[model samples]
Target chain A: MPEAVPDQFQGFAVDKKENWNRPKLTSYDRKPINAHDVVLKNETCGLCYSDIHTVQANWSPIARDNLVVGHEIVGKVIAVGDKVTEFKIGDRVGIGAASSSCRECNRCKSDNEQYCKTQAATYNSKDVRSDGYVTQGGYSSHSIADELFCFKIPDDLPSKYASPLMCAGITVFSPLIRNLGGADAKGKNVGIIGIGGLGHLALQFANAMGANVVAFSRSSSKKQQALELGAHEFIATGEDKDWAEKYDDYFDLILNCASGVDGLNLEEYLSVLKVDKKFVSVGLPPVEEKFEVSPFTFLKQGASFGSSLLGSKAEVQQMLDIAAKHNVKPMIEEIPISEENCAKALDRCEAGDVRYRFVFTDFDKAFTA
Target chain B: MPEAVPDQFQGFAVDKKENWNRPKLTSYDRKPINAHDVVLKNETCGLCYSDIHTVQANWSPIARDNLVVGHEIVGKVIAVGDKVTEFKIGDRVGIGAASSSCRECNRCKSDNEQYCKTQAATYNSKDVRSDGYVTQGGYSSHSIADELFCFKIPDDLPSKYASPLMCAGITVFSPLIRNLGGADAKGKNVGIIGIGGLGHLALQFANAMGANVVAFSRSSSKKQQALELGAHEFIATGEDKDWAEKYDDYFDLILNCASGVDGLNLEEYLSVLKVDKKFVSVGLPPVEEKFEVSPFTFLKQGASFGSSLLGSKAEVQQMLDIAAKHNVKPMIEEIPISEENCAKALDRCEAGDVRYRFVFTDFDKAFTA
Candidate 1:
């Protein structure tokens, strides 16, 4: 073990449920590194909507008193356990929403570990493989993850840009690649709803994959920006009353990337899909929120409704490779890692004020204690 | 026009909505034959669960007084319009649920006329292209449909067996062929829910498509029958408490051919699907019923929920060809077509007295009035 690796790690965490937005600087302990574990000194971490949702306890009550929520971690390897062959000291890598899964399951063996029943999230989750320790995330000075979930950061991609791709990038990239025939996606019509953090990256990836991308947003405010981000067409759903009529049966694949589901007209979005196509939602609303559709709506076009979580470890590697190959960069606002800055970023993210994503940097300065 | 073609077709009609179950024999006018019209002398028709649902006003109120309700029609073409090239006089033909569609639309041009907005049902639907005449279905002396919506019965297929294939057959066949890679479905794991009208045919078609078929029924009573009808395995869902646990992530494609949705645990059915696989429903429950699932259920395996209507003309012809090639035959009970016999068949069908399906035959004797 490296002498520089701290016994106690520092991070911004939420201590009180009511004061969720006001994260406080705090110290936490990491689990003992196992044979397959690699310790990462986080260089940058992306502020995701899930981070806010976790602190606010929207999905579930905080499982731990001090919940350090951040999963899109881009860092350099500081130490590796005996059996860790995938990463060595000084290797740049990234970790997304999931940190570990029961590797013995068929799903894990088949490159679908994200759907494994015993999979552990990067933060505020119990690591059953490691003595039931509550896992902390990349907001801390160090993050320890099984080598299976850690992805090598491409040399062409910088840490700040790669941070958001760890979460937002994989969320959209997995579906597009899987559904749109991977490299054979040329000339396919892809519709992306919402032009925020996830949607913005979806546009870049879909375009880079050679799909004709269309951006769907509530207003025309993001039309120019969406186009700049690689969308060939834009549909302002709020302004266009006849949008459904105009684009009826137009899209080959429509991905719902909106952050929330309130007032979402799912039938209208479904109406635009071609026969036998799919409408997959990646942006999750609150856990209580549900999507309802008449059976006839699906029957009308033989269409399907589906959703996806974070990508598999293999898919995460592929996503990073594609990002590097296409030079795909997320529009990120960099914030110095501090208790006050973390609180401000959470507030802005909740308000949808950020232009795109927020990546926290200066981890060394913030964690110095 | 031939001398055999009647100026007015006679059928069993439901006059009053309250007395929907008791239909009376009545005569009705046929739309003036257009360029693409094919007039058929009715021979046999399948009594589908949809027939009972329609006649009993389960889907909608009796659209018109004396509405005739039947769709799976098989007969000999007695007359053809000037532009009808697909069928000639005395050619055997069949018409499923759809009677006609706006042939100029993209959906129609692409062989998906069943999904066209202007598509007309065979029974109690207004034909927009034919002076808005109410269309009567196969429980009649004769029937008329556009050549585009009519298909030629294969030489080797008999009318009694081919009747159900028109509606019940295409309804299940389209989804299987579309989702399971058509002829390339060899060795794929396919699950069929329910063992009644649609399901029985689904089992045969999926098996003939070379899939490893599994049948799911409420009780063990149908286990032997399901196996005999080409299922490699049978699951008695009502008796098996751990069915979902036993078959988790087991299926590549699952078709919900169950007649009703009374106590369907969709999450359980979804749990058995492999990651990125589909659960498609061809059965139409009451219009008021909706399938609800939490978004997490779909995220768990990237599984999809979808539904399909009756197939297109091309797909119907392909289904018939496959039936002929594979010697696929539906299990059916024959009933003579009469006001009394029709009512009896509907009653028996509602009570689940029939083994699988009922085909109304002896049309010449029953419609002689």
Candidate 2:
């Protein structure tokens, strides 16, 4: 271990008293990395919709008190434990949603570790090996991860573009890869619903994946942006009353990225799916939000509706590699990782204000002296 | 054309005035077979739940004023039109749910004519080519069909067993074959919900298809019956409240054959499906029946809920072939296809009184000498 490695680091956290909606900046002690763990000097971390869910106490109770929330992290390995061989100091690495999964489990062995029973996320989750400390994410200068979960960021991918790829990039790409049986998804009709952080990247990934990408938004305002993001065509459901019927049996896959589909005619959205096709939704609306579906909808086209979690470690690596190869530049607005800026970013995210995604940078000023 | 084949055939018919509940015996003039059509001398027609639906007007409004309802028809081919090369006189033939589909459509070309837009059932529908007259079914002594839809019953499968296979057998087998990627479905955990006509046959086909079969009924009384029908295990959902949790992520495919899912805890049934698995409902409960689905249910297992129509011509033959290879015998109660007997059978089916299925026989005594 390097003596220069700081004993303490600054992080933006949420405690029981100062909850998710209003998180606070607090200094936390750096833990000793295990033989399998690597300590990273995080250069960029993305502010995702899931971060808002943590701040707002959306799904489950916060996995830890004073949890620093950010899963889309890109960094340089500052220190590696004695047993670590894959990475060394100054090696650029990245960690997505999953920090650790029970590698011995069947899911992990099958490369589906994202659904592992005892899986732990980067934030708001307890580390699989340690019981004393809850996992904290990359809303800090330094982040620690088990080497198995940390992916080597290819040199071609910039820190800014690579950060959001951890979440939005992987979420969209996993389903396409799963449905098409691999990343060689040629001649597939990929319909992306909503054009936010996840949706914009979905369009780009689907395009680069050799699929014909179509963008669907509530309003026509994002039409130009969607086409610019590699969507071959754009359809605004709000603008076209008969859009669903018109494009019936058109798409082989529909990746829904919109939040809160409470009033959305989900079956109608499903109309675009061809026979035996998949309509996968990765967006996490309120856990209680109802998605109305009729048996007729499923019977008519012999289609399926599915929900996907974040990508597995292998998938994350593949998505990043693909992004790097295809020059998949996500439209991201960079902000300094500060209490005031994070608070403003959280507020803006809830208001659907970001162009695509918000990447928190300048970690040196935010944490390290 | 055989002059011995009478132009007038007696059948239990429903008119606009008499309605579904009060079908009466009526004699109707049979039309001449077209170039690619065959005339069947109906020997036995299975009284299916779909027959009840048609006779009782359970689904859509009757497509015919004088509808003679019976789709699960097993009989001898009496006459064939000029272009019909497949069948000669006395060849055993069967007509499943769909009797005709637009032969030129993509669905027909791909052996998915069951989903063809212009497909028509054997009864309660207007014929595709002969639109003026109603397409009467095998409740009469004779029924005519487009050669494209009629399948030759293999000599090994008995007429009694083969009758129900046209409807219930194919309904259940289609989804399993579809999900499993074909009829050679070995080692898959196949769940059959409801132990009636379709469910029992599903159990047999799944077992014969080399799958581990699990039968789900409302009561424990069906346990022995299910085992007798080749089920590896039986679950009485009514008796076991915790069955869903106990068998969570259990089945790769669930064939729901129950007439109604109105009161069933559908989520529990869905919980039994594994990741990327499927739960297919083939029963047409009611047009107004509403299904409540939680997005979490779909999200958790990455499973699908779908409804299936009757099998296509190819699937029906495949199902019968599988059945013949396995000596799959359906527990059927034979009844005469007289007006009074047909009425009694419909009521019994509604009351869930049949052992598994009822094949209406004595077509000669009921129709003509």
Candidate 3:
């Protein structure tokens, strides 16, 4: 039998923009469960760059006073609404950046719910089904989401390891699978720019997909790590002054996974893509950050510039299955869920101090101990 | 039997950037015929926007003192080099923007020679096989080019019609066929943004490809003409403020054939593309012009922005065959080939005064009448 549900859920919330990093432990009212809703007892949640961006108001001004930001959520279903057929009371599941979408739209019906016009973000976005209820994220004791957005965790995958895959993994995986001929991407040259949370996983996914994976970072510091993580070659872009020239027209697909675009030379990166290929960015810098390229630049190599949002629930499940099969796991540091740790994790992530990712664990201890 | 080849080619050449529109009749030396070279007695040449840009130095300063700047050349082969096997002495042929490319390169071998590093333009660009011989374009009595670059015009297609198809037709057709599931693009919502030379041809090609074609122009003036040119619907973007909203997530493919990006709301156009679709540009504005879009803009709908150069040799042939098969003819105005008419054509094209395209004919009258 599942544990009794709480009327209010507790989590670390940023009450003010000025004190964004220093989140405080607080309780917030949960939305009334809908027919397709499933309530999860939060076990682990990944610390994504998006979380830091949200709290810091880099994308937009903090819309809600008690905005709780965490989307790479992994937990157990404690409750399932009457019409929730996908999940039972104790199913292990995960939810990524998206919480819900109007299921009737063409995009939603076509497995592109992540880009639905009325799609709601996992946190700080208004729940269309509820009145004045802004959706809370998984940086909490419990998370209630439409069962359609929740993906079942593969039994072989650990909850902690599966956390970051919810967002970072699928963000990279979808574009790779879509562009690189899916499961058999053999002999294709794939480049992963900025080996951070997403790039590292992109390297692994591209490699597992049988592509000739190349990892590009600012320096040589992550060279060994990138190779160990599945890159066939490593390019220290900052160290090599002639990297772009040397690798001109090299990549079949390049995934830009850098968290920021400061000092990013988009043209130099674009110069290395083969004709009729694409450079897809899954790591968003800021809402205001624009990618500028001369039309001649794209014309020269017949290249394209595009970005993908988080993958659909179907893609998310496929990603988890692929991850489990290929042993694709994010290098993560486990942190006990607490107000101080959450603040520290955000600070460290903002500072680019984390090796790859951070996952909040010890949820029961943080909430009840 | 074919007529004897002339020692020199005569054409209207732009001697000064300041007097770009006032082209003067001049004689220039042609590159010595190579094994793969073919010489043609020019009959009709299309005045493309590129001709105006080249003479006016909009793309770059005139590198040559006398730049003969027309690429859409259609003529009968008068001379064939020793190794030219594709055509005999009297074959009717057409040559578009590209004149020659290093045939050994992967791009060249793979039918993407238009993007080869050493690809030579039909005019102004340096002939890689020759020493300091700048290629002079058509608008001439006779033209010389690599036979590989010379495509046999379909017997059913008139020389005047085939002239614009060389450059303008293939520019739009390549991208359409490449993106829209070539040969049969039925039921796809395809938008041709701009109803000028390139845009006009794009409409016919997209329609011929069996797409649900929509024409987007600045005003309703071209509504009747656009509808007649195979557009199922015509949208005056300037007249309708809510067109973007109304057609949000609508197009399967959008070909931006607008010659200039002045007041072009890229975001608004991008907003209408369905998820994972592309907005491709075949029109060339000035070289310095840059396309800027926020990452979030592309992320929202999973749309891509890309541009294409002139089509490959294979694509050009395919385009011509398709045009011939479907009667995809460009609406053209015929002008007699002369220094005065060439100047007038350039001035008119620069002012956007031409209806769709201008094809210069009566080559013999201009040179030897």
Candidate 4:
């Protein structure tokens, strides 16, 4: 071996020093690639609410010390093991929320790797095959992952825009494409509720698939942005009192991306569903948030309520290809990857200040500094 | 004009006696048929729970005194106007729960006629075309309906069995056939909950369509009957403590037909759904019965929950043709269309005492008495 690898690199970590907790840059140890794995020099990563949840210890379990958190990773395959075949050195690549899965399980075999019982998260999770080394995330400079779980990012899509697609884009894209019959066949009207990270991408994908895209947001601030993002109509639920009433039983499908509201009049959203319409929920709100609807909501109207996880690798690739074909680039805000910007971006997202999505750039310092 | 075509016919009406309510034979006026309508001589009509609700004035908002409350009407076209082309004077036919719709609406144009805002029920509902009379059902000797709403029942199927196909059979058959990609598709694991009227026919239809049919009921008493009706396995929920647990997340499709529980553990049923599985509710138990489920129940597994009404006129005919081709027949308990048997059958249906469905067979008395 060469000289010993350093025990620290510049990365973001929550400030435990103050009474009002916040995250700041710090040095952290990085793991080396195993014989069957590859190391990605992450160029950019998206700042999802999921990352905020991790640092803030909100809906998810409390983050342990040095639990570097980011999943929507876009990078270059700087190193690969001897066993890798599909990926090699200098290949543009991406990694989503899922880091590893037992390929032998049924869910994994069927391309639903996200649902595999033994699947590992890219952050705050234990690697499945590695010998007790916990999985770090894309927030760090170098992320060592099994070759099977890493994805090849397309050349046409930029790293910053590509980062959010790995998580927010794919989360919405999977259900919209899968539920409504994918890239080829366009079905009826598709409603994208909440003009947040996922919703913005969903409008693009739905419009890309030749569907009538309708955007629903609480504020009028995003109306023009949403329409410019290929939405056919923008309904501000906050500004418009009779939005739900006027559009009762109107949409064929509704993608709900908003999080954390108790007794959300899910029934009201359901009211705009025509017979045999499907209401899909991909957002995970509070664990204690309950959804209640009258059986007549289902029985009288013949509507469906469902949920889905992130897209499979194949599906993600398909979505990327479709995005390329339709020129469906997600609207994004890129921030320099630094300790100060990390907390600021999280605060922006938490306060509903993001126009759509925020992606962090310049991961060179995260690895080598 | 042939003595102005006598409006009233000898019919039965509920009367208040000294101590009890009684059905008395009396003259009842028939609703006039519009230009777009056809009049049918009821040959056989199937008794249903809604009819009982109407007769007892129990579910009052849905009930009306003058409404002849039987929607499962298998009849012969006795009269057709110049506009009626789908049916002729001698054709055998059936009319389901829906009688009229605003044909100009998007729903009606798309063949989703039942969900039209201006939809009229066969009984206890206002007419869309005429607005001159309340639509009466098949309990009377003669019934009038817009020809567009009537379905052509196959000649080979017995009228008694074909009558319930209008309501009970189509309610279950529509979802099964639609979701399974029809009866000819392969190896779909289908579960029919509640082996009463709807479940029995669903079991037959699902099995006949080359699917593995599992019958779910509360008691073992229906096991032999269910198996004889072509169920592959009988799951008596009460007898088998591990029924839901053992078969958790196993079924591809579950048709829930049982009603009246305040809050059924729908999430438990959802847990029994395979990936991308659908749990469709066909029976409308009661309006007050709420459906409770956690968003996590839907989100984590990506399962679907919904309901479907009776099949369309075209779908109904297709189901009838499929039933005839497969030699599938409903196990119905035939009751005469007299005051005594009608009341008794209704009571038995309400008490969960009927084997499957009760078809009212004696229509000659309504024709002449």
Top candidate (DockQ): 3
Residue-level lDDT tens digits of model 2 in A1-369: 543667776789878624565667887876667777888888999988988877677767776657788988999888888888899988999888877776776667877777766777788787887766677888987888887788888887889888998888888888889887788778888899989989999988899988888899889999999999899988998899988777866788888888767767777866667777777888878677766555666776777777777777788888878887888988989999888888888889989999989999999887753
Which ranges in model 1 have alpha carbons more than 4 Å from their true place? A1-4
Model 2 residue B194 lDDT score: 86
- Candidates 2 and 3 compared by lDDT, better number: 3
Per residue, candidate 1 scores C-alpha lDDT tens digits across A273-335 of: 888889999998778777766566787778899988888888888877777788889999999
lDDT, candidate 4, A108-142, per-residue tens: 78877777767777877777877566667777776
CAPRI quality band, candidate 1: medium
Candidate closest to the true structure, highest TM-score: 3
Ranking by TM-score: 3, 1, 2, 4
Candidate 2 CAPRI assessment class: medium
lDDT of 1 by residue, B197-256 (tens): 999999999999999999999899999999988999999988998988988878999999
DockQ for each model? 0.70, 0.53, 0.78, 0.54
Candidate 1 share of real interface contacts = 0.75
Alpha-carbon error at A78 in model 4, in Å? Answer: 4.3
Residue B286 lDDT in candidate 4: 53
Model 4 per-residue lDDT tens digits across residues B182-203: 6674677888888878888888
- The most accurate candidate by lDDT is 3
Backbone clashes for every candidate come to: 0, 2, 0, 4
